[model samples]
Target: MQETILNIYLVIDKGSVTSFRAKAYEMEGEDSAKIGFLKERATEDFASAFVFDSPKNKKGEYMPYKKFSKLEKQGLQYQLFEEIFEKFRVPQNPLICVTPVVDGEVFGKK
Candidate 1:
């Protein structure tokens, strides 16, 4: 059996006004590629707050909440990505990265 790979790109504008653009592609390969991309306007007011909300260990290290034989990280990434997308009303597509640059600074991606 062969595997299919998907790539996504997201262009976000969080300066003065908020906007988003998305692109996707599909390919055949054994390994998958990055799922998301971020592009922000040249302004300090815009910040990226979307991140994989994973569990942390006692030592302040990030860890997966569950175990999986394959695509665990990818799954988690998608899950978190979806959460942000839904919150911001981003479009959905396979093999694409949806980058969102929002207003304000809220630092924390785990």
Candidate 2:
């Protein structure tokens, strides 16, 4: 048997910058129905952008902007995500990403 780790990446726009992380975590979970709901709730605390984990088949592959018709290569969404990360203390520029890297685990049925 193997256990899978699931994580969601979200951008927090804290007005003060110091309290955003706390606010972001407070709203993330499996129970979340609407991504916008979390963002709206946290608007007072900070603005947030949540990136749900891509399907396994899509792993390691490039993800493009949802609004853009072009494929990942031409998509600027990834770069935009990085731009948001840089706003925090993260050192990486648009080229580097701060999203959580997750590994999956499956168990055989007995």
lDDT for each candidate structure: 0.33, 0.29
Screening candidate 2 with a backbone cut-off below 3 angstroms (N, C-alpha, C), the clashing residue pairs are: 13-47
Residue 33 Cα positional deviation in candidate 1, in Å, after optimal superposition: 19
Model 2 scores a TM of 0.23
- TM-score to true structure, per model: 0.27, 0.23
lDDT of 1 by residue, 1-110 (tens): 32222222222223321222222223344333232211222222123323323334697654322331133355644653454455445446434333333343322122
The regions of model 1 sitting more than 4 angstroms off are 1-61, 64-76, 94-110
**How does residue 85 of candidate 2 score in lDDT?**
51
**Per-prediction tally of clashes:** 6, 1
- Whose lDDT is greatest here? 1
Segments in model 2 whose C-alpha atoms lie over 4 Å from true places: 1-26, 34-76, 89-110
What is candidate 2's local distance difference test score?
Answer: 0.29
